[model samples]
Target: MHSTNAPASRILVTGVGANPGFGLTRSLTRLGHTVIAADARPHAPGFLLPTVIPQVIPLAADPQYSDVLEKVCRDLAVDAVVAGIEHDLVPLVDMRPRLKATGVRVWLPDAESVHACIDKAAFHAVLTANGIPCPRTWLPEQIDEIPDGVELVVKPARGHGAQGVHFVNRREHARVLCELVPAALVQERLYGHEFTADCLVDRDGVASVILRRRDLVKAGLAAVSTTFDDPVVRDLVVRTLNAVRARGVCCVQGFVSDDGAVAITELNMRIAGGFPLTEAAGADLVGQMVNGLFGLPVDHGRLTYETGKVLTNYVETLAVGDAEAPQRNGHSRPVASPAVQVRPDARRNASPFLYGAETAAVGRVLRSGQYGHTDVTEEFEQRVARFLGVPDAVAVASGTAALHTALLAAGIGPGDEVIVPSLTFCATIQAILATGATPRFVDIDPATLCVTDTLIMDAVTDSTAAVVPVLFGGRAVDLSAVRDELQERGIAVVEDAAHAFGSRTPDGRRVGATGALTCFSFGPIKNLTCGQGGMVIPRSPQEADRVRRMRLLGVVQSQDERANTTTYRVDGFGLRYQLSGINAAIGLAQLDHFATTANERRRLWRAYRDALTGLDGITLVDVGEDATPHLCQVLVPDRDKVFAALRGQGIGVGVHYPPNHLQPAFATWHRGTLPATEQVGEQILSLPFHQHLTDNDIEHVVSVLAAALDASGGTS
Candidate 1:
């Protein structure tokens, strides 16, 4: 019988198909413990392990991942959970509380430590902050600072397994690779002997490190390695582990440079793939790890190993021929199933209409290290200008920023009055107020649900500095009439084209193409979104330049400083309202697929229009030929009852506005009774809309809405 104080327990090991997880599972079982192996891939080879119970789980990014993992642990009665992969670390760290409540132990570092190890940029910062020697690193935005012909390695800042890593000698190549690599980080390529340290940290923060020289590395895995005793390397590795506050079984990798200096590369929060070499060299690594995992003392004496113990790894097929498709468990259900699962109060208010390209663009910006305003933001601005056929465009942080900057640029300030639609978003009034100008609320035309030229002309006075005609529901207003009347009276027209990005006039001119100052919103529910961003299409380059300066705290040439590290002069008033490079990247990516997305959106809107043509108690908004609807809204009776019924059936609904003039914050600004605006506010209901909604989803939503209208005693 085996004599050991470490009790045999049921352990759940994730990423079992990977070498470290697979090897760890086998070793634990050999030490007389039950192994429950889990993997996101159904056909993971670890499932073939003898006497192991295997379960398939969702990828770490899945929304249902946490629930599925908890269910697995609860069902299997797992005593401890061990993550075998780096990607699983964040999710597991988030689930630590629930797992502990179920009496399952986990051996991992704190959230900050895990992130530091996983994110290369953060790791570089941590080590550098602690006076540790590490490779010189630069974010993509700082690529221009790299010396010419310097050897560089462009890799994902949050990468694993050497995937998407590129090596080059020119700074330009690094820049090009940044576009391709996800969350790319540029570093000085290290040359010399690479080493891996198999490490174990106890609860008291004491760490044991076993040094090994990597003789040959293939595809990020050590092909040939030998255990060695180097106090210098071991000491440095321990210092790095401490810098990251790492705990339990983890790995530290670095290189002994040609200059005889050790420069740490990265630290892994889990066991090294070649840890078996340590065990072969006489260290009971896994045994001691389990001892520390279950609240027992680690035998440091057992961690000692002899020098020159070699390990050679070679790939061999563990299985041949056709393999059976493994059954997916724990929230991996088929999407094609006819039955729809509805959850109570699960109606999403608004969701970003994302495509896979958004992630790719975000990765490029992250790798470039220019999270602030940079080339990507400029590129997006240029694209928007071209698409709208405008002379220039200025991208800002939000729609309100765009409006505020545009008004300020147009010389609107205190003692000035700006005409706004009362039935529109409160942001319109807020933007005017932000410019220190009074908002003159005017009633909307009942036919268009938009402020007409007559309303603007009536609200005008000697104090009227600008007229902001809001395009409701992606529909264009009487831009020509408003522009002609307002300009003759010396009143500037700043079209609040927040909902009319793609809408055009009857003359075929895009809504933003010909306006003096057109502000477009890219908020979450807007037709096009940059997560949360906005742009201003200026009539002249001078206006664009002024808006740009105003966005960067009114610093003249501030944008130039972002491109090249240099001092800038602040000459006027400005706000820190510049859009970030990452959000701009998302916007550029969204434009790349705008054609498809716009067409799809139009198709869905048309479908809704056709289905509800004669439906009683609800009337669809009359969208013109030049209009591309951002929202499918209806004027309905018993709006609250219909909203509740639709929400109860898992359909999301929204009330566009509550009459900005009547809002508590704007109640003081309330002037005359705008009967049209008040009546429309009570009747308008915005239906769920986005690029991702399928034809089936639209049909289902319409069906629920029709039933809701009938339940409220509406004529059908």
Candidate 2:
């Protein structure tokens, strides 16, 4: 390890996927400091110390993704970080606090200079306002914002690497897009050769021309790119840099207008995708950035913009046939391998929406250096709060943590009988049991696949201190009546909204809203997943503080309370259940798109219901008028055969749950029999669902199910 007091002389290389980032990884690895890389794709290449977190997230937008990168620095003991793409820079800049706070350094391009980096409208507005050469641009917010005569391109105000950009000559396509992303930018298409200029600026504000490339991209940027350098390009790049106040590496995109004036497109703050070329040309940017950000020094010959480079990138298809795929969709549903089992929330199977950039930004500060241990966990609080529209959110290490925190916050302890549905995930029962409370498994309602209000009443006893309503398939049991009843009995309610994230109760309220302590799961298999983690949103400040401290290994309160102090001890006992900054970073990105993800799920739910509504021998769980289903579930006859047949075709399906009573640990918790939970356990089949599936995949799944059911002597 490097000396504790020495200035951090190392740099971080993240997102080490393929030979694309190999050059970067190799460069950092050779520097001798601990070089860590993080990527979800196992096939990513290099001397990768691959984990699940990268140095920069949001790739471009700062709506806040720096949190994850910062956390990685703190947790991994990294000294400096280098964002290898335009999408990496801004969020890193935005997270200056978290990074600086941890003493880890990051080089951020001047914001005013990089403002044109992600926001096309902001860039256009800035350019138009400054009389800089710009394409005809206007905000789509105006009346019929599409360009009337010329073909126009529409892009988001703030986006990463151009996700939803489209060009259309017709007005209709522009209008349709305007409806999709409100306050988008419409720019008249500039038909000309596109190019990029790579730059490096030292602390002294001296800008170096690295390499300018002739950007050859197909359909925006899916294909490969080949770069060429020339005087015209050189002049444009120098002028563009001069126009902006950036003092770090920046890649500016521009087009040679038909009139010969170079019309600037956008400025990218981080090293562009073509940075490897800069390295290939002799400028070691990653190493340079590490030195520049931390006040370190480096010697280099005169920088020259290099030319004539060839690079290519290709994606390989990996079949995750049955090896426990992570989550996709508004809810945490299993992966469907063969017949696309898309979750209700995944609209186009476009890689499932990630957590909000906000979470990623904060997580960076929390996780970014060696002084602090790496803390990556699930969205234990944010997910629950979001699902229930609660104002408070706190993430924990696991779903079990969520329940434990909730139980403790609600004052359920030794000798307390917490009425819980025997049909839910074991984590729920385990959480309560960890609080020294006994779980009372109440019968579930077959229609909703959740514990019923009447069952709670039947199971209630003087020892009953709280009631937990467990949900399944993103569908929930009506808990309003039970909640009111429990309140009357002076019992607390901790709703396990683990599987009910996108679900709403009848009367338009959500599952966790009315609960005193609501818990949610974002485990690799639950809604809005992050490998493993959970959340608990309490109703009171006292409960929130307890949950927060308990998550952080039982601290008294915020760092403010413990600042300048050396040690801390638990006042009431706790465990290490704090969510990792890295994990939270992912959760942060995923949650931002939750609403869009949720709506897609509802669409899938409708399609499933409509397709199988009249089928006999199979009962689709009714979400009720008040509930919006997260996962599409059904009770089918010959369930085993249907599941087997689906799997035989390489489709992965799931059983919503096995009754808790069957678990050896629950043997004495509720020794009483629960026939309803038992019966549903055998018949309930969770079809594959996630956002990564196409509509055709869903149709195929329905068709396969229909055929399998008919073969098993069931009618549709």
Candidate 3:
């Protein structure tokens, strides 16, 4: 009678493919509420649930994810949203304000509390600082401090579903695994009977806890559980929840050792996968949760549960092979055909692929009616800025636009000169020409294929305005050393990082994070593509603003005006180089999977390196450990003949560049003699490298190249 009674409400639940979301959706339907189950995958099993609406949403890491969720909530008139997976928790919490504007209720802990539970290391620190009983945990850097012969658990600090969790008994093994696991945390292994507390904390901070013993576990899911009653355990669960500042519905897990002491393991800010047992044991958990969700007072009498009731889970086949059938009422249905699968060998050119996220993003822009530079473009810039650890980023039409904008913002013009590597694409020279500045071509280091400090210093003059160091094939130039030698002289270092989107430095810092100015390309062949786009990361706020203006024809405040639906005046000189909203949408989608794509590229390059080792008449480019290779380039004798031979065998290959100094347009401005660059230009050949290439494809390429070498009678 707390005025919380309302008609059945519509709710959206994320990660419905997982056990918690799936189960939660089923329970909500039983309670007479409409459920919208969402998942990143199109064919998630949760979509098959009766009386539930299924939605395909982009992954949380996607740049446009929050926007899409907001649109969905508004379109469907959803009344509430609940996260069923840890991955979606952070995004939903961050979108609280937007959801509130739409009057969609969400029950979740604060951002800090949610993060503390999701990050295991933070959870351990919180409990330990609060004088709670928890296992000893150490970060990867502290692995050496662990004693020998002690059982340990090495796992990713932010992992869920027990993935990447490894058990070890030696410090050495832990140390070795620390190198493999991302953001690893090592903890002392605990042995005892494990229990889960299904908890609900009302808005007033009062708690209701249901204890369940996990009698059997499989793949991190509780397969069998029994209801239990223990005051000592319930009190400890409440205390631990207080320590972490947890509210709303959550689950706490721990162990009861032989010494009769409880040590906390981890806390999840979501319902337990085995939560059905609490209801089966006679507790009205879900009903009270819905009441609390609508700001109603909980009924404590209904929260009581009987002890010794058991629930066992088993796998069942809910679906089988695809089939088509006509309705009994004589209605016909259309059945779509399956997609055709293509083999890697069938393609004779470099692979340029697209993911579903890209198509969805582009479609979103097309429907929004604002196709010019808009909010989506700004969001894409912000995402790239965060990824590069830079203060600001500007998106433009192409790699040339990025460099042109950065150079103009840096105050370079007619009388100034920009130093560039001779062994680079023609775009570098074109950008310098666009700035009305002279291009000073310099020789590159034979091994790195990048301009060195010695070459840069030797090329410097009183008229030198900047140094443009090209990150050729994703190999990072020694920017730190280059800065030390050039910054004191007041010359800017503008990095041409077109081929190095996800490359990192030796110290683990991302490439664009530092340097005076950096530019990235998203052309068809780059690591992360937006179909066609570019980005500029500036060191200072003033430069960022200037670059922003320059990209839109010098129209002052055009970007702001577009977002606010206002008009702005034209200012100083600029160009129509701003990236379109549709392209930015694609770029945003690509950024979501940038890390995975980069790692896969690196893996493919390594496989090629290992397979071709000691091959006669072929020398691989020595890409440094810190680099993420964009293309696998090698120096070969009779390069043109080898290139033709590979193409004939359906193994695509090409030359990266013919030295810029030798190009007709750049020949007039060439100043220095680039012996190393000229020599490399004649011998370098780029191999087909992309994430879609399999090991078998690589082996075939190697075999074709070896045979071509033998036929040419070159250094057998």
Candidate 4:
């Protein structure tokens, strides 16, 4: 039932499949005022929202979702339409006047600013008009007029990210260039230092800024960034923002030549991708932007940040899988380890992960120096790479470090902003912050837990950098569509596939194989246990090479005998976060156990469903086609009581998470509500069913759950 009393203070956020955008959408809708989510994909994460809230309009409306988006504003009498995806932004802006005519509002950069923000050539020209120097460029339409002495760089005028930028050494590729560019540009790539700036210009035209220097870690998003107050670049940013006439959370990017001239590269007319870092650095950007856009007064000059501080992605390490247990190396009925490292019994029940292997493994590694090159480590990384069908893999210290390393290789840094989901783990947000880039926490789809396109568009600004999609145990986010959108935009995407090691999409491809940089975890709790290790799988060999060197400092690691050694030419101060040899060995052993492990999990999941399906109010996860059961999840009305009752019965149950936005450190950006996340979060619970459990164990778990539900009055 739609609320007739919905307030105008409510904002509707769309883009349900994309992570951050969905986060924003969920947060707003939870406030119980008004929010309409729309997505092109039917099963996008946002659509999975509980039926209690009005359903998200399929981006493909009844007439096709875009049309529905228009009607939603009129029907709901919504106050503002939050544009979430970049592709959706322009059209939403085009619909603005008609929406307003019906008394609804849509937040977007004006059409002119949209073109300037999205098109490389148009953006460069605008920058030049504002006296902000850009890379020397000649559009293909003006190709014959190219002057004789411009040492050549080339790019497609309409391109986004680094898609069309190329260094042309030969004239032969010129014809190849035309296919990409309606007109390509032959420019002089300058000798300049790259940096990004997160600045906000209020409706009154004031610029508040922070400049960060890109550092030594991952390339696409910064492994780390240091802030510097550069008056020159900051002023240039102001000039560029003024030229674009953008009024939201805009981030501008440019380069400083050796001669110290500042040139504008582009503008993010919406919320830039890297805004999360700003929030983590103690800046409440979402609240500020929402406040600023709605005719609220913003104090732009009141912000300040510490210089040279660093943040890193939070990490969950991997453990190598052991080969099938029965026939593996003849270590049949195992003897006890020399010293059993059990936790003091009481704390053991409170832990989520299994530390049985780790306790034994860590003690051994400290004694044996063979950590990196252990047969166990190599075997596990190789198998995981093969399982994901990726070309190569490098085991790192943890999943967070894997993301940080992938960003370092991609070259994301200071002044850059990476798009992330506020509904996801704090680790992703912190990873971008570590690189001195801003993290734009986009909204999320409540059902799929994936991000939607609408949120991505609303948050994009001139300094927008990259996009990251997290597949949380692979329920419903489709990376193929997300990849398509990002590719066309010229931005890079990195997959944070920590919880999705063995999952697949509706298409048969593995979750980590979607032509993007994917990072996986083998933490103690993952489907495949690595006491502590991670792997980065890139889409291309060049990208693979880039991440390879960046993973272990800047020095390259060739595929040679010496490549496995620790002693080498370290290029920079890299983190000592490589996976240990001991952890690797355990992972390899688990690899032998893979088929059975996965099979057991699926069978257990089905059993849980069949047994619990007859009950009322407890909703078992719907895996649709194309998903490997990772955790057995259920939604119940009285979660605390159910959880407590099960615990009392000695049947351990778990929770997937608490939304990152509500964490105390992030509370300032909470924006008042996150109904779907908070409500669903409470009802969600994971049942125990590792390979060690038997069929009888499954029955016992179901019985306990049933009794708990009945005791809690859910059956009534």
Sorted on TM-score, best first, the list reads 3, 1, 2, 4
Task: Go through the candidates in order and give each one's C-alpha lDDT.
Answer: 0.82, 0.64, 0.82, 0.63
* Number of the top TM-score candidate: 3
1-716: candidate 1 lDDT, tens digit per residue = 11235665778898887888888877776665667778887656665555456668888888888898888787655789999889899999999999999999998889999999999999999999998999999999999999886899999999887788889999988999999998899999999999999999999999889998999999989999999987888889989988998889999999997777999998999888899899999888898999988989988888889889999998755445543332334443221112221111115545555544576689989998879889899899989989888777899999989999999988899989888889888888989998899988899876678887777788888989998988888888875766776778778889888888788888889888876688999987677889899998887878888998899998887556545865667889999999999999988877865665566567768877876877778888866767777877888888888888888887888988889999899887789899998888888888887644544456677788889988898755
Higher-scoring candidate on lDDT, 3 or 4: 3
Q: Would you list the clashing residue pairs of candidate 1?
A: 139-368, 140-368, 140-369, 141-368, 184-367, 554-574
| TM-scores vs. true structure, each candidate | 0.54, 0.53, 0.55, 0.47
| Candidate 4 lDDT | 0.63
Which consecutive 10 residues in model 3 have the weakest lDDT in total? 328-337
| TM-score between model 4 and native | 0.47
Higher-scoring candidate on TM-score, 1 or 3: 3
lDDT of 2 by residue, 515-607 (tens): 457787877755576557777777977788888888776767555456667875667677788777666766655565465556656665776
Give per-model CA RMSD: 22.7, 19.3, 21.2, 26.5
Q: How good is model 2 by TM-score?
A: 0.53
Lowest lDDT 10-residue stretch of candidate 1 = 335-344
Cα-lDDT of candidate 1? 0.82
**Residues 429-496, model 3: lDDT tens digits:** 89999899999999988777888888899889999999999999898887576687687887888889
RMSD of 4: 26.5
User: What does candidate 4's lDDT look like per residue over 48-150, in tens digits?
Assistant: 3321122345442233555667666654435677666555666677777787787766556678988887777787788778777677666665656665555
For all candidates, what are the clash counts?
6, 61, 0, 114
